[model samples]
Target: MTGPRLSTRLRFGAAALLVAVGAAASVAAAPDLPARMVTTWDAAGEPTGTLSKTAGMWLVPGLAAGLLGLFALLPRIDPLRENVAAFRVHYDRFVVVLTAFLVALHLSVLAVNLGYAVDVTTLAVAGGAALFYYLGTLLPHVEPNWFVGIRTPWTLSDDAVWDRTHALGGRLFKLSALIAVVGLFVGEYAVYFLVGPALATAAVTAAYSYVLYARRGDDGSDPDAAGRTAK
Candidate 1:
């Protein structure tokens, strides 16, 4: 692929437009909720309350867009350009979906503030949205760039490590999507619905690294062996 023919100026301008549009939409869509401390019961029969009210919903998209616009204007300076071509589609999808999830999450917070009882359907949709967005981060082209993907020390050290971790991450994210989808039917266990998948994903990724390391030998002498083992 020759890559898109977009010049730096055009790309920057387009990105700015997107940011403006997204910011406007997010502000318009978000409703003002009360400042009261909202409480919700978790799966363990404990009530949890913290400040869910956020101005970030209105601000983060624009901030992200601004950063992206800056990157477009000077992609040569953008660190993510290294492996971007490899994961272009995945990266693009990830950004779009992630933005959507953020928007949805902010909207849901607004709904809760307006006294809309967070029900099973709402929980499921929210979870699903988040999971899908996260899944995009697992694409091989995505890698351990600054803003996306799993950015652990191990993953950042070697391209092989990053690739393996992301592959594992993709599967975990897909599983999380399934778990979240099923959670929709289980009702108020939504906290568990969310927590379970996250924990599972973390556990799997950690285990994957450990297993890969062990198979690679203590001296770190066998790159081929390590890759094969991870695979």
Candidate 2:
């Protein structure tokens, strides 16, 4: 059966709550913040760049709103939207998780600038690990679609390829999340832990999909299902 559509509760409640908190914090902190605030950090978690106080405060909330909008829109625009509905419940939860991650990061940044000794980078890496781990759980349940999962030339062409590749992807992503979490304690090298594993998972999943595609072709499976799902 197709999964339920994106939850109105998520859209109006959890997401709204996060955005509201971000905005409220921005308002409360605006007076004490400098005209420009440090907003970028290097991989080592050192502050590297700045943004206007107004921009700094609103950045994540604005981005979150945009992302939530896009997430809500994708199912309508996708050709394989029915497949998206097949996992819509998971999809909605993913949206909430991602928004919360951003909110956490935004709050960390605000606190650090306020003289709190928050290790913003450590918090970011940890949040990333959580997000990636949840994504791992979500992948295997994804039906073939243009907007999500391990899309590749091969996976999009065949349902069997999509399933196997996503299954592999699900495992690899979880492993990546685990590896990334170790970065939380590795000091300056922590960001690399997340980046390295994530990149490897992407490369491995794409290659796996292609290999599955070619083998299926050799085995005489139809390769003409392209328009249904894939990049």
Over 4 Å off in model 1, which ranges?
Answer: 1-80, 111-130, 133-137, 143-147, 217-231
| Clashing residue pairs for model 1 | 87-141
Which digits, one per residue and each the tens of the lDDT, describe model 1 over residues 1-231? 244534333444554555566566555645654444343434643436545335434455655666565444432455876666555555554545544554454445445556666552355356564655467354545745665567666666555667777787777777677676676666666556666777788887877765655555466554575456788
lDDT to native, each model: 0.57, 0.85
**Candidate 2 local lDDT, 1-231, one digit each (tens):** 322423545453687788789878889988888888888889987889999888999999899888888887888899998898888888888888998999998988888778788888788889999999999999999999998988788888889888988999999989999998888877886999998999999999998888767865566574655644665
Cα RMSD for candidates in order:
5.5, 5.3
Candidate 1 structure lDDT: 0.57
Q: How many backbone clashes does candidate 2 have?
A: 0
